[model samples]
Target: MTNKNRNYKPKIGVIGLKGFPAFGGSARAGENMMFYLKDEFHFVVFNTNTHTSRKTGTYNGIEQIVYPKFFIGALNTFYYYLRSTLHCLWDGSFDVIHVFHVDAAFIIPLLRLRYRVVSGHRARPQFAAKWSWLVRQYFRFMEWLFFKMPADVITSVSRPVAELFQTRTKRKILFIPNGIVFDEKSEILQIEEKDYVLFASGRIIASKGVHLMLEALVKIGYTGRVLIIGNRSHSPEYAKELDEISKSLNIRFIDLIKDKQLLMAYLKNAGLFVFPSYHEGMSNMLLEAASARVPLICSDIPENKQVFNDDETFFFETGNSTDLAKKIEQVLSNRPLAVEVAQKAYERLKREYNWKILAEQYSKIYWRLIETKKPLNSGDSEIQGNDEYKAG
Candidate 1:
């Protein structure tokens, strides 16, 4: 955040979204949000020098600064943010700084002293199943620091996350769930409607429950094509386990699809979309599946529940392979029921989670911050949680 006393478009310094092309959920969310609000504000995204070779580039009129990272890929978040913050402080131009995650936002305490910092509490990463006990404990410490720090506004993609942070602090926490822009152009893959199943994650890790899905498919002796899209760099051992279980089944593990249009093509053609993740704040893939009008089978986790109901999307008991198998069979066998569910979920997404509307709401908060730079208190927490946020 920086001073905004000039008569120009308000500038926002963005941190914590691994630079622009936006492969992961956090990065995708940041890119879409800024794209929607490009007319209202100017954005300067702080990226790692490794993100792109171009030291300075533009994505939809957004300025990007690829700052240097220390020790290669390790601790890039820390070095990148620290450098970006210092740049903002020295330049003293940006009116707001939006940090995407708790791990990337340990510097909020320092940033808030000068700028109206908006820290997004996206997930309880400390509970991530992929992390070791020590790593999880480190995430816990980061979360503790994030909540205690003074942020002007906190945005959560899940209502449960917003409520959880609200109980822990008096600062303003807004439950602004994720949204997707429906691709109206038809992208018909040469696959049948119920010929294959689709599962996608940015990283192929244990927390995503891909192994459970593979086991369920094995239990059912599924013979059709199964597309598992993601990279296995996150967990080689777990990925090897997945390969071991998937060998007996018709599983095709595809690398992560970074292009949204291509990903949508796969989603729209899939027989069913399975989301068996054990941890998440909100998922961009789930939102995209809904937009694609595909029947979803998600784990009965609170994060996924916030997006759709039992009738709208099938939910299996979390970590239960048998239940997931049963749900998968039910969705595949009952085509009419699956179609109804997909239609309903898509309608709900359009009504409640439209990206344009959510982007407008966020910009409104930014405008409020620009008008009056101050910390939000408990008294206006309720009023500020919704669209009429009087504070940042």
Candidate 2:
């Protein structure tokens, strides 16, 4: 994109998150939204080298504003948050300012005075065990600003998170779920099926509940090969504990990867895919596993349930190692039933969680904010799409 190519499209400045073309999580969410809506909007995404490590430049057609992210305890993230907000304040080219994460709390009020602001509420970072007590307390205030700030639109990837905000604030919260890009050319690799059990995440963290899977493996005396793939070095102590627990088990550790196609290949080969995450904002990994059509099991948390019911995918009690072990055994022993369940989930992902449909829903919200500058209260209005994800 050059000025002539701009063609009078809406210039939206996106802040918060590491970068576009991201491996997964919120950054990936931003990438999918921009890619799907590229023709209708012009996006200027601010990124941090701490995650992408890509040079500051254009990714395909999108312009990336890159910076280094520091790790000063929990406050380390503040480096990116503070800098990006300040930069957005200075940049006058945007028609709409879309901010992700509650950390942008301090700037939303000011941004609202200048331009239309859309708050992306994805997760509650305060609940994660990695954050210090002080940081958690600060996040609570940040979350408050996220709800209280005068933003034009508030969209949540998780239906439960949206409902929680509505319950507390009595405001209209839009529930726009996360989605995975379907690769039409994707073909299963020549890997054997039911060969091993798998658990993967962006990084090894306590909130992801990897220990639940390990303890379940030991409890069941599972001797099958287990594959634990993620960024182990991100949390050295947790990685050490995972290694210790797997001493008696057959385990293979692979470095965390950003390649979605490669991940789906790994997912397809697994005999059983265990997603024991305790919390999520409509996990992209879970969606990918469903899209992979692999035998799967996930924790019975509200976030996972909103995506798939009991019949769509196997579920174990959250944090219950014994239940996870039992579910794992059930999925492994009855492969035919597991396959049927997996197929159902794949269908659901296509019908409800497809990125094209969800992104179009986002486009609806954006145009309403841009053309009319009117409030789209999802509570009483029909602005929200796909009623399947409506809170029960």
Candidate 3:
């Protein structure tokens, strides 16, 4: 490997996501990273299937490699990872192989190439209640195996996750929090006549605590419309239960929205944005709400607390519907306090959670890893690093 100069843009192979037009936090993270860093590096994102007419050879300027389609389930994800790994290994084009989630961590060991490996540990998948006993055990095993696997760098999106990995494995981890971008030109969706509207978005899974949100709404006798936008495929049974509960409660369930502008409109027009997740690596939805300057009420989980303090957000007990209801009531009843909190959150997002800032943070990490793998020459320029390396 020769020394890379300032102009040398590293080729990065991202191995995660079933395909393009993907959903969920992990997919968005990957897409946003590529968007912000495409000019700085050459990216080739791997997709499972591309038979659709809209499937293109590239997204933005990054290349996309499409593999044969697989069945929909955990097995499909495994197959996608396995196939993508083999392709990257054989092609030998990437300077770094960045895996986006813990499930793809096991494949790191099999990539016997000169390329560096970087993986993201999003959350404790084993702790998610939607998974069956067997599936949870498998996730637990994978979680354990992930730390043991050979990776040049491991990152977690939240301080809590970073601390857990550091404590358990005795290895340094990069804490690169998630970020949000607002579309200025996006048309705002008008909220109809309502005293209050509470909006929440994410995968409609048991761990997300949508049920708890619903229960809180019921307990408080909220008269306004409730909008929940998310994919329900992961936990259909739980979603059905939520559906039954929402019929009399004026709650509207919207499937995963593909349009960023429309989603932003929802955030912008909402009287309040509530996040009742039991756990998270870091919430993109919460960051978006903060970006849109929406008054926020979220569970007091470590991940949520990492992004917003008590002054910027109202905290409710995790999984406690009564407490959540009380917090919601407090925010709705007090308009001035809500506006103050929303302004603080928006300021915090500007100072800390902008995508450009996060992209620079990630660039530093990538350069550090790349520099470590190369032989240090006297003439080589050292990568200017940031203080994010100093763990708390």
**Clash number for each model:** 0, 1, 0
Better of 1 and 3 by lDDT: 1
Among these predicted structures, which one has the highest TM-score?
Answer: 1
Ranking by TM-score: 1, 2, 3
The total number of steric clashes, by the backbone 3 Å criterion, in model 1 comes to 0
| TM-score list, all predictions | 0.93, 0.92, 0.89
Tens digits of per-residue lDDT, candidate 2, 190-275, equal 55545689988888788999999999999999998999889988678888999999999999898987877677778888888899
> Residue 133 lDDT in model 2?
99
Candidate 2 residue 303 Cα shift, in angstroms, is 0.6
Clashing pairs in 2: 72-76
Q: How far is candidate 2 from the true structure (C-alpha RMSD, Å)?
A: 3.6
Cα lDDT of model 3 by residue, 155-235, tens digit: 778787766767566345667878775456756676553334655555788888888888888888876788888888878
Candidates 1 and 2 compared: the better one by TM-score is 1
Error of 1 at 365 (Å): 1.4
Give candidate 1's error at residue 188 in angstroms.
6.5
Number of the candidate with higher lDDT, 2 or 3: 2
